[model samples]
Target chain A: MSELSHRLSISIPFENDKQASMARKTMAVDPVLKSNELLIKFNQEENKLICQFMGTSDRVIRVAISNVIDNVKTIIECFDEFDGKDDVQFEEKQETI
Target chain B: MTQDLVPTAHYESPSEPKGYDFIPGDGPHSTIGETTKISDIVINAGGQDRDTPSEAKDTALGQLRARLTTIQDKINIFLTNKMKEEKSSKELKDLEKKMLDEGVDEGSSDNE
Candidate 1:
């Protein structure tokens, strides 16, 4: 059996709530069977990941997360993504602490 | 941080809906007509300048009092709204965690 050990971290920056919400839905159906909602964190916070799932290898995790990101792009194509609101903010972030 | 710094030029005039006067919390909680109108800015014709030292001190004290009251009101509004948002965000986060955990458990079983 495969180790089933992996960690997938994805940071998607979008200008508004519509894009963020779309990103969440897209991640729910990742083809790699590791789809999970991207943690939507407020930009002000020091800790980016508001959620996480731990497993045994980074390769599997990366493939799963990449699938989610691709799905998010698909969602963006179908709908109006970000409006660039005055108060709205976005930041793509990832780092190993 | 530099990111938090808003361009001063962006606060030009009332032309921009998000002006310097714009409240930071969610949307305007003030009722229509409840706030002082810009058009109401007018110099009182009967108002006289304070010439004496005592009169100047009194005027200064009154101005300080008014400013303090305005600051207090803003702080109260901010704290109230912040508490509400915190409570709601916490509840939503908890729900998201439960759903995600269930999904992860199902995935583990699938691997089994």
Candidate 2:
């Protein structure tokens, strides 16, 4: 019997380090789908979140990559939502509380 | 994030017919071949034609920005709800502790 392996790496650039860090934190909390068959890693460098995945088959690798991409999208959306006008609103709400 | 990125325009090489001059026997009396006339036909050369127009590219970029805004709004709603839930849970815990302490205080006063 022989083992097949596949790997994928993707770098998502953000506007700033804060955004990248937030993305890294969001993605790091989620556990991998198939722990035995796939592995996922995330690293933050300046304004980019570097993602890597390894799997036993092409399907697993692709699935892992897509899942991470979705997470990154959510994180970017969060940045766009909170980084400007929303921050002032959030602070005002906190003060009222 | 992936959806927000705008793709640049792409072009493909224009398909032009190749023209060649066909000389019939090589002397001044030789008759020109039929294919030789193809050389006289003007053919525009150089540079590939754009597959997508500039207007189309602008529209696509606009659509991508719109979609990104929508996604951001959804995320904002989700985060707001999460914060509200957390605040309410914390308030509930504080109220429970206050009630417990007051109960103990009342019991001690009654005993004294």
Candidate 3:
């Protein structure tokens, strides 16, 4: 419960609301570690993904922020590699079995 | 000849330069030793005048804003490419499916 010394907030804009929502959902699934030393919150506002971090030190804040950014990168990679149509086709194929 | 080869008893010691020898408007006259400051590598998120706790927080906020903007730019580019690829591939798959269905119908009609 020491006073959080550092705070960082970031808003990443997406092309549309859907992509922002996807990013928010993906990030929400992963819980932040060291909740006492750091806090991470993510929200989707229109076409922007808003991220906030509060930590006791610069290192903790930076580490939390970077970890989220890494996850965002992975989400972007998945979107690039696969589309909703492919997922639908996959599901349909599985249903036939 | 032997005296000329002999070391002098009053050998002059190398003297240190009084100050940096560089012309005011010209390039460096000699190489300056490499030096690094913490401020050079570590961002003083709170500027040099971080006297109070609030001031330090403000500096950290400023740094966060700057970093976020950079991250935003990167994510924007990646998302754009992702969307473009998704659209193109979906179109291609739709076209292939349509062609396959048409060929199946033609084969059935010819068998009649």
The candidate maximizing lDDT is: 3
Better structure of 1 and 3 per lDDT:
3
Which residue pairs in model 3 clash with each other? Answer: none
DockQ of 1: 0.01
Considering just chain B, what TM-score does every model have?
Answer: 0.39, 0.48, 0.42
Give the per-residue lDDT of model 1 (tens digit) for A16-72: 455456445555443334334222221211211111333333333333333333343
Model 3 lDDT per residue over A2-83, tens place:
6664555666655468878988998998887888888788888887787776666545654566557646645654553453
- Using TM-score as the measure, what is the rank order of every candidate, best first? 3, 2, 1
In model 2 chain A, where is the ten-residue run with the lowest total lDDT? A1-10
Indicate the worst ten consecutive residues by lDDT in candidate 3 chain A.
A83-92
Best by DockQ: 2
Q: Candidate 3: lDDT over CA atoms?
A: 0.49
DockQ, every prediction: 0.01, 0.02, 0.01
Better of 1 and 2 by TM-score: 2
iRMSD, per candidate, in listed order? 23.2, 14.4, 28.9
Docking category of candidate 1? incorrect
Candidate 3 lDDT over B56-109, as tens digits, reads 112222222233334433333433454466578779999999999999999999
Tens digits of per-residue lDDT, candidate 1, B18-88, equal 43231223322221111222223332554433321111112222222223223223433433454466578
For candidate 2 chain B, the 10 contiguous residues with the lowest summed lDDT are B7-16
